[model samples]
Target: MTSAAERPLLFLDVDGPLIPFGTSSGHRHAAASDSSASLDQGNPLLERLDPGIGPRLMALGCHLVWASTWMDDANEAVAPRIGLPRLPVVEWPDLCADAGPRGLHWKTRHLVEWASRRPFIWVDDEISAMDRIWVAAQHPAPSLLHHVDPTKGLLDDDFSALAGWLRAVAPSRVTSTGD
Candidate 1:
């Protein structure tokens, strides 16, 4: 049996993977001023979330961590709507923490350190070659930086790839049920 500590971390990003920007047919960006106001009235984008995603994610058997700009707001505003419990939130460092190579994502460095050599899956819309290279060089354990399309959110193929990688890295930590 795998211990809790043996479970790989699933660092989930909310905006792109959970709450899609808009339909695949079109993309929409809320004005800067409307951002905070929209959160107060209820983010219209949240409606785009597929409530079924939570179960599919949980079924993957990784330890889910909220790795979004939404922070605690993911637990407060997003969790209940999607049927997920309050997950551990990844506390982001200050803005200046981003001092990596040119194209490396701001979150990549922190996430690698947070994982602490444990295997992890970083699901975000912003993953790039730099991030992948950095994680490959820095993190000792296997890692997957799965990129989600903000316009489409997480698709069936995205989930399949994530599950596949998890199974490959930690076969004992996950049980395949033909999902």
Candidate 2:
């Protein structure tokens, strides 16, 4: 069996995948009660995080890492609300230095570096074909640049897709025999 460190990584995004945006989704909230929301933090949309998401993500069996612009704040403000422990945060390098091909999302290059050739799944709202093409050339291992709709955060379908891909890629290690 591969060590947990050798398992694929899941690079999570905050604004889109975790906290849905846009007024049309019906998830947009002005504020949440202090209990549900992150302690004393002021991002009203923090309430949009589905508390059930943490367990769902944990079930995927990949090493979860925060790749959002929220940086370490995701560990402090988001993790607790979703019932996740502190996860590794991808420290972004200079924005100008890591820019990839034009039209690539700003995070594309940095995430590829952070994965360091291990298979990885990048869950974010801004994934583009350009980013996929670049990673294909730059990253030697398997990768999925899964784009989540910002208007609606991760739904059941999203979880299904993530699990399917993870299982397919690392069946022996990632497959959980039970729900």
Candidate 3:
């Protein structure tokens, strides 16, 4: 059973899911909508924030976390301006020992430390096939991983998908902000 205070964790990825094509034709049809920024020269994807969705996510009992390559700097810099709730940043291990060259064990490492024992949703533009496979391994009570594409940028599909998944996993979908 889940406690009332704990929100369902949402591991938000910065680049692909957050910043996408900015109403431009260049990347309009691109699947990921990734490109370099015209002004900042930083990845344009970093500039795309899903409007009015961050707070809703928080309200829906999601403890959002920064789980991107930018977890250290880039993502953090952009999150505040975008209204994403401050997050507990988690990092991946150095290498994938057992999985070998193409093992994609970073997901596995994160699973063990973070999501393996908790319920989580991964919002990334880069969740590969290996990621899904690894998630499947942890069934039952381990975790419920929801992959949200940044290109969609918090579209109804994203929220409904998340809400449904969360409803099933985190029965107590209300988080208390009692500090």
Off by over 4 Å in 1: 1-5, 31-40, 176-178
lDDT by residue for model 3 (78-111), tens: 6565666567777766643465336454654565
Residue 82 displacement (Å), model 1: 1.0
Q: Write the per-residue lDDT of candidate 2 for residues 1-179, one digit (tens) a residue.
A: 23345789999998879888756646544322323345465666776788988888887888999998777878888999898999999998887684767899988888888898899999998899999999999999888889999888898888888878877787755554224
**Candidate number with the higher TM-score (1 or 3):** 1
Write down the TM-score of every candidate: 0.89, 0.85, 0.71
Candidate achieving higher lDDT, 1 or 2: 1
Best by TM-score: 1
Cα error, residue 136 of model 3, in Å, equals 2.5
lDDT of 1: 0.83
- Clashes by residue pair, model 1: none
Per-residue error at 84 for model 3, in Å?
A: 2.7
Count steric clashes of candidate 1: 0
